[model samples]
Target: MESKTVLYIILASIVALGIVVFQYIYKQKAKSKIYLLLAFLRFIGIFGLLLLLINPQFAQKTYTLEKPNLVILADNSTSVAENGKELNNIISKIKATKELSNRFKITDYKFGSDLNILDSLTFKGKNTNIHNSLSALKDVYAREQMVTLILSDGNQTIGEDYSYFKAERNNTIYSMVLGDTTKYKDISVGPIQTNKYAFLKNKFPLETYVSYQGNTPVSVFVSVKMNGKIVHRENLKLNSDVNFKAISIQVDANSVGIKNLEVKVSPLAEERNIKNNRRSTSIEVIDEKTKIALVSDILHPDLGALKKAIESNEQREVSIFKSSASKNVLEDVDLFIFYQPTAKFKQSFDFAKSKNANTFIITGSQTDYTFINNSNIGIEIENGYPQQEIFGLLNNAFTKYDTASFDLTDFPPLISDAGPILITSPFETLLGTQIKGLNVQQPLLSVIDENSSKRALLLGENLWKWRVQTYRNTNEFINFDEFIGNLIRYLTSSKNKSRLNVDYEKVYQGSSNAVITATYFDEAFLFDQNAKIRIQVTNKEAQKSQTSPMVLKNGYFEADLTNLVAGEYEFIVSVEKESKTAKGTFVISEFDMENQFVSSDNLKMEKLAVNSGGKVFYPSQIEDLINDLSTNKAYVPTEKGTENIVSLIDFKKLLAIIIIAFTAEWFIRKYNGLI
Candidate 1:
């Protein structure tokens, strides 16, 4: 196709012609028509071979008239069909407009918690997530001219806000607002906020957000009911409509185990929506005391701060001692926190190591790396250099526990020896060191999970600086105290001694989805998904039992127990192959989320329509909506062209032609008495 290829083909043809002339005209005695035919066949075969060598290709063009995509995203959640009559009217209107498919490509989808292509709507979805629906549509029809029609009540129960979506300039979104938008007298109790665990004899706080929708001032009575009895009560004066008040209540933890606390605001006489006036949450009250012994080389402020932080939790008791005195205390405590252990503390360290106690070591200038390396700890500090100040940066992938409070953006740096921190065994690093504003690939805080013992390492000292700096910034020690407490809790907690581990909460709200996850480990302590984990659940109140198998996903087994009725429940998780069993109890407290709101969010739907250059319409205005969409200039169909490049050598017919030409020439040569 190019000039260079043409020139090469011409040169090849000339060479073939000279060869044919030499073979037939000069060498052959007979110069008749047969000889000429033979020379011509030879030249033809040579030129055909040269052409095949060129490997020419051509473009195959295709033309098409692509219609604009009309995406109808229908909300199939329960909120959309709260009133069956209104939902039916909307569906009937959508079906009546099916004739629009004649000019546009119609694509129907249904969205609740997940987005899916719709065969039909059943309106059985439990949660509504409008954001996921539109985002999924945007990803699927990214390059197509699309006009989306969203029909919903616009009550999103989960995921991010849908108003933040940036729709394409050419694309349009028309929303059909559903349900009643008129204001209704209502009182609702929002989510409960409280600590997950409480100590016996200590009082824990419960905070709830109470909202009201009424014009007149009302005296709302907030009460905490435990075990079906009122434990605490208070009254608040709500002055205006659309106002929210935060109420805090404290309850004494008189006994251990899981305690279900119900917080409710007594509804007004005229309030019609009373289903959301109450909320329930549970907390575990434990009596076990985790005794920790702090072993230090010398008396320092860092040591004292660490002791205070660990002891802040009522369940934890920290005893500080010099390295010489630590050996005597190591036998009495469950965990050892060694601060800057030097040669003098070698005997105490060996005693703790021999006892197989959970240990957390903090390294500093006085830390003897040689002595630490000789120990069976999972990490070894190599090429030790001068001490340096390094800030802490959270490792995002750490899955040991909730790391949301590990944010250290404004926190000061800690002092540690500068060098590569080497990890020798299987471990997880929670924090990495950052030097001079650049993240370095060195673990600042890490956990080592060994079969025999659980160990943790903090590759720095001067932890007192964090407490001081945090207090200076926020006028509180919440960050540093929580961080240190969480670290100690993680280090001191018992290791996964069992091959099968079930992770779940003690209780869950009835209206919310309940999920329990389990991990199965083989004899080698490796995650084994094929171990076959199954759970036997029993309603403790009714004595009804059922068994279900957990599905394996991403090296973990997950069981969804969301549809269970409100009652006290117990579950026994068993691994079929391992013959290991774990039992746990949880209560599903009654709470109806569907009845929280009685009206649709028409404002959200209006904003979605306006932002996408479209109009919002009610179910009765469907015909007008259809007319507007059909007349829009940008929504019309457009011609599209597609081109494909195909190589000539790839065609089987061309190969057959080449074979036939070579065969026929050979036959003609043989018949003409030419070899």
Candidate 2:
């Protein structure tokens, strides 16, 4: 239909011309001689071969350029909580980008630990993992021509490691710093209380960690105030990155009936925020009392020591019944302390069983081992022989620090323990090992549930002597007073509630929806009670709150919080009832926004344009980029080696040419005396 002068086309045209001339001469021939026939054959062969070489090409290039897609990912992480509404304003600007639609398709990503395109938003995660976000975007659109524009503060959380980015010289990272880089001092309270329960009217130790950031030095006020009264206060001055700057507070666990305790820290005037400077924890104190019974064999120095130790416990009543006393005393006791208490075995065991009293056995020279194992109690000390006086575990907890307080180095030791690791039948173990008769670990401490329901403490060796030794740590309790005080407190402690802990790994941009979960272990936390949960946020101008579900499984309730903004948010759960009030707190964080900053680096948005024969532009250079794209400024010319698949679509011209070629070839063959 149309002609162009290129190498292959010119050669094809010449061959067509030669075939036409010969065909015309052949057609003018009058006779059908042998030479005519031969000439006609040659003409047919040449024209047919040339016709196959009539190469034609068709193409339509629309010299139009489009504005590449522009994704302006905004950071919504908590780190930027100080920036006020600057970030929101920027996000709004990009969201209303309809004017740039022809030149660029803009997507708004509001991210923290991960990336989430903004819509009428509802809930999102806390934390900032920007590196992960951009990496994820890159993986999704590796073949696309898109430009990623990052607007954030310089404090990066995730991305290529700093070393990797610098090592690889990934210069594609275009940063539009948002927050003012001016250093402003800030102090925060991170670590809080570890234990949830304590004895009423007693001192409870709480650990809190404080941190200071920025270039300048700053002073902060730390206080433990209860019901608006200042109980404890400390003034501290801190420099940047100083570790171990912590404060410990020993607050009185308000008497047995009090339930709420508030601990607050005073932030400096120049501080970033104040909500995190204070927190409140709820607790209940146990004051239930009990009565104890003390049983000893001889009036040795050890018996006197035992009496004093058992007397310190207000709940325990020690009645020393020497074996020689008249057997006419009627006893109603809760616990029994047997110091070499092996006597006319039948009577003693019967009284212990009748009173539902737990027995604590201490072996000595007059002990009869043969019938003891048959009575069902204590660890089996088969090698009743003397052993080395070396230190080991007290129970299951290992004591790494040694002190002369419990000076057992003079006597052969029996596994170096004062409590139990085993238990016996017909009785429940309160602490330590159970009695196997022939062994030493029979209820180191136990509870008998028969009649009076009493408990016992079995001092395996002579611990009264160690209370008189000297050492720095536990040695302070080197006297029977402090030592026994610790003992009584341990025995009378309550075991009621179970602690609820929620743990999960954080996922950002490069993450899939992992199982966000919570599990419970405290039995006191009743799943049946509608436990209400409220999430508190401090990142934005207006604090946001969300209620979590009460989905219970195996005594634990779960609520999956996925697709959340990157930042940190705290969840507060409260259970209100007629007789009990319980509360728990947990935190969930995402570094997606911080990581998006990192991920955005590896994504070569400008390179995509460069590779696909396009130019790059900034917000101000959009017009020029468009103008160049509309012309031949950036389109790379095609190569000649790969043009075999050209096709021409002109039905009329093709049909006429086919008919003319056939007729011309026929006439030329006849005229040339070939046919």
Q: What is the lDDT of candidate 1?
A: 0.81
Best model per TM-score? 1
lDDT of 1 by residue, 180-233 (tens): 888887788889988888889899998888887778888888988877788988
Tens digits of per-residue lDDT for model 2, 1-675: 355525556676566556645654456554445435544454545544544455456654444444444566666665555453665655565555454454555676777666777663322334556567666667655654455556555455545532122211111233345544445455666545635556655777877777766666777777766545677788877776562377677878666642344456677786655655665444445564455455556566666666666665544556777544433552654444556545455466667656545555655544544445556554333424442232222342323222224333332232232322333434543334323223344444343333323334343555555444423324444344544555454444434334544544322221224333444433565444344433222323235666655465565555555544433344444333322323333223222332222112222434433443333444344345334433432222322233243465354565566566557656775785545
- Model 1 CA deviation exceeding 4 Å by range: 1-47, 50-59, 88-92, 95-99, 289-496, 645-659, 671-675
> When superposed on Cα atoms, how far off is each prediction in RMSD?
12.2, 14.0
Measured by TM-score, how close is model 1 to the native structure? Answer: 0.67
